[model samples]
Every structure is written in C-alpha cells, then in structure tokens.
Target: MKRVWGSFFLAMSEAIVPLERIHSLIVVLRGQRVILDRDLADLYGVTTKRLNEQVKRNRRKFPEDFMLQLTGEEKDKVVANCDHLRNLRFSPVSPYAFTEHGTVQAANVLNSDAACDMSVQVVRAFVALRHMMINHKALSVKLAELDARIGMHDEQIGEIVKTIRQLAAPEGPRHRRKIGFHPGNR
Candidate 1:
C-alpha cells in the first residue's frame, strides 16, 4: 500500500509540467486564449473541483490583475475559436481563469510547504521560458535582416550579369563590327 501511494505521488510530481509548456501556458493565460478549467485541471493533474477549491481557499492572494472570472463575451469568443468547445452549449457559471501573472501569484497564495516549493519552481521555469522567447524574437529579426541583405546582393549580381552580357554582344547592327582594337596599336 505504501509503495502504491508513493508511486502515485511520484507520478503526480512528475506531471507538474515541463519548461517548454510554460510559454504556451502563458500565452493561453495572458493572451486571453481561453483554456477551460477542466482542461487546466487535466494539465495540472488535479480535479477541476479541487482546483477551484484551492483557488477559493486563497482568494485574497489573487488580485483582479492576477485572476479574473471569464466574461460571457470572452467565453463565447473562446468557444467560437475552438472546435472542441463547440459542444459547450453554456458558459461555465463560476469558472475561474488565471492570467500568466495570476498563476505566478498563485504560488504564493496556497498555504502549504509543497505549494510554496512548487510555486518557486514554476516561477523559475516561467522566467526561463520568457527569456527564451525574447531571444528567439531577436534571432528572428536578425535572420530577416540577413535575408534582406542576401536579396540585395542577388539583385546586384543579376545587374552585373546583365551589364556583362550587354558589353559582350555585337556593338551595332548585324553588319557592323569593330576592328583592330589592340593594346600596342593606336
């Protein structure tokens, strides 16, 4: 029984989330890309009810900026964008949505040593993910600049080839030709 429980705990711990998912998670949260409570619960490996309970239990920690209940319009927009959500005929009455900032704040709100530790790890992962995104954006801009320069060089080469072709062609009408142009003879 102890072994089984330990294995369960280990599995839950392993499911916390990898760093790569943090960026997408932030986008879903802050970008108003709505992920339902049920979906979030699955991702976090917690029951939806339990997740809501946790949030309710620490309501004071979550400011309006950190978390907000989704408005009807927002929910409708989400449903429209997601084919999977088409079956959701009604908006969730009390579904709480956490923004990226809110999720970070949540780490501090939960009243447990484990929660605190997990929050710290999650926050660090978020920071690393944010840095990676910024770096990727910078690299993309640099690559675009390089591409533009290469295009310009290609145009210049084409122009040089055209000029060379023109110079090599016979200088006049078909019957006309230049004669005896030599270095030593005027």
Candidate 2:
C-alpha cells in the first residue's frame, strides 16, 4: 500500500503542473515559489483587478495568511524571475498575494459552479504533486547511495579479476606429463 501510494505520489509530481495547465480552467494562481494575485486571476479567468475586488469584498474569508498584497520587493523579484512579467505592458503596478486556499476562496466568491469544481480538483492535484516531490527527493538520496555502493563493488570485482588472472598465469615452468602407450597390447 505504501509503495503504491509512493508511486502514485511520484507520478503526480511529474504531472501536476502540466495537467493543471491542460485543465486551463484551473490556473496555478501562484508564482515559482509564491502565489500571486495575477496568477490567481489568470487561472480564474478574471482580470487581476477583478480578482482583488472579489477578495476585498469577502475580506473576512481571507486573513493575512489566506491573502495579502505582495510587497514591492517580492513583486520585483517575481518580475525578475519570470520572463512573461519582464514586459512592461503586461506587468502590473502591484500584485496581490494568496495561498492555495485563497484561490479556492476566490472560486466561491465568484459563485461559479465550474470554477468551484475546477478549484477542488486543482487543489487535490497539487497535494498529490507535493507528495510526489517528497518521494522523488527520497528516491534520489537512495539512488545516490546505491551508486556509491555499485562503484565500490566494481572496484572490488576488478581486483578479484586481476587476482584470478595472476593465479591462472603459468608462474613456474610446466612439465610435460608422460603417458605410456598401450599400442603393443592393442
């Protein structure tokens, strides 16, 4: 059961981002390492401003942890890291911040049944992906250990082969064995 889950986890990690994008209806709503308002809007098929408006309207649903505005420095960093954001035309003066749940909350605020369903599915996929990443990291560590052991075994095997070759080599002069012929009797 554990192994099955681990395998499923690994597969999910490899697949999450790609699958999320394919669903198109479900956006990542986050940046490389952080969730930004613009991303949420893009995923929810709303303007960035509209997304913020919905959050503002339902302020109680989102505390600081659930949603916040991105700091200038964070926004700048995001722009720096993201090629799409590098262009001035698409870049916003400010961006909002939200956790995964914030986006889910946005779905509710929008009151769209489709968005709600997509959000739930996306969240589940993300969770599975996270599990897979953890499993992959563990497997990578194990693989490193196995590689080291295999390298050591290869060296040991080489030494053994060398030793066997030395033993097989004729070290001393070979004496011919004399066999008496029974030709006369025959």
Candidate 3:
C-alpha cells in the first residue's frame, strides 16, 4: 500500500506545472476567476468538443458556480479584450468558463489519467493564487502604517524648521518715543 501511494504521488508530481503557466490561463469574468474550456481541454489532452460533450452529459455534477456559459455580449467582450481569444469571435458557440470547482469536476467527468493528474495541478495553481493575494493584502496594510508614521515625522520636522527660522531672524532695535520733549530746535 505504501508503494502504491508513493507511485500515485509520483504521478501527481509528474503532472505538476509551473504556477506562472497556470496563472496566465486564469481570467476574471463577472467578478469570478475561471479557466476557459479550450484551455482546460488542452490541459486534459482532449478536444474541446469532447470535453464540452462530457460536461453536457454530466450536467447534474456542475452547478451554476461550477460552470457558466458566457452570453453573446460577454463572449464578444472577452474576445475583444483578449487578443489570444480572438478565434472565439468567429466561433458560433461561446466557450463555457469553469471556476475552480468546475475545473475539478471536469477532470472527474473526463476520467482519464491525464485529466486526473492535471486536475491536481490546477487545484494547486488556484491555491497558490489565493495565497499570493493574502500576502498582498498584508503588505498593503504595512505600507499604510509606514505612510502614517512618515506623515507624523513630517509635521514634527515642519515645526522644528519654523522654530529655527524664528530664532535666526535678526531682532530690530526698539525705538522709544520721548514723552516730554517737543523742542523744535533745528
């Protein structure tokens, strides 16, 4: 059993892909992060038509959040926005976009060695993205705190400069008026 598990892990490792490659394939649509059907198909080592057919057959497995069909307008907008997806403009049917859950479900429907291996990789990619986002939020908070500290120092420096300027200015001589002297002796 240990050997079996080890081999299983080895297979999964063999399928592991670079985070950058998977990250590039991810796109945000309607505020949801998703991977296009064509891209998923490529990862699964199957034709796009075959993959869509499987999804249609296992429609019950996919909920709204799992898989969503792009509307004509949305599809057009995606095509316009992404130069790499330009071919979609000519296709009659817009490709389905699969969220993280949907992507894993797709692998189950595919039920192939390559599908299973790549599915694990896909999940890892999504997790990595989430981790990075969390780190970014923490960094943003730290930067905001540093900015506030610097602002406070600036105010202190400004007050010090004002005091220095006042001390440096020469004091003019005081002129005292004679109270009882009104002599016009030129």
Q: Among these predicted structures, which one has the highest lDDT?
A: 3
Rate residue 116 of model 2 by lDDT. Answer: 70
lDDT against the true structure, per candidate, is 0.60, 0.62, 0.85
Each candidate structure's TM-score, on Cα atoms with residue i matched to residue i, is: 0.63, 0.61, 0.81
> Which segments of model 2 are wrong by more than 4 Å?
1-34, 87-92, 161-186
For candidate 1, the lDDT comes to 0.60
lDDT of 2 by residue, 151-183 (tens): 999999999999999999887877865578766
lDDT of 3 by residue, 5-96 (tens): 21223353265556677788888888888999988887776788989999999999999999999999999988887777889899999899
170 Cα displacement, candidate 3 (Å):
2.9
Q: What value of lDDT does candidate 2 attain over all alpha carbons?
A: 0.62
Global fold similarity of model 1 (TM-score): 0.63
Pick by lDDT: 1 or 3, better one: 3
Error of 2 at 70 (Å): 3.1
C-alpha lDDT of residue 90 in model 3: 94
Looking at model 1, how many pairs of residues clash?
Answer: 0
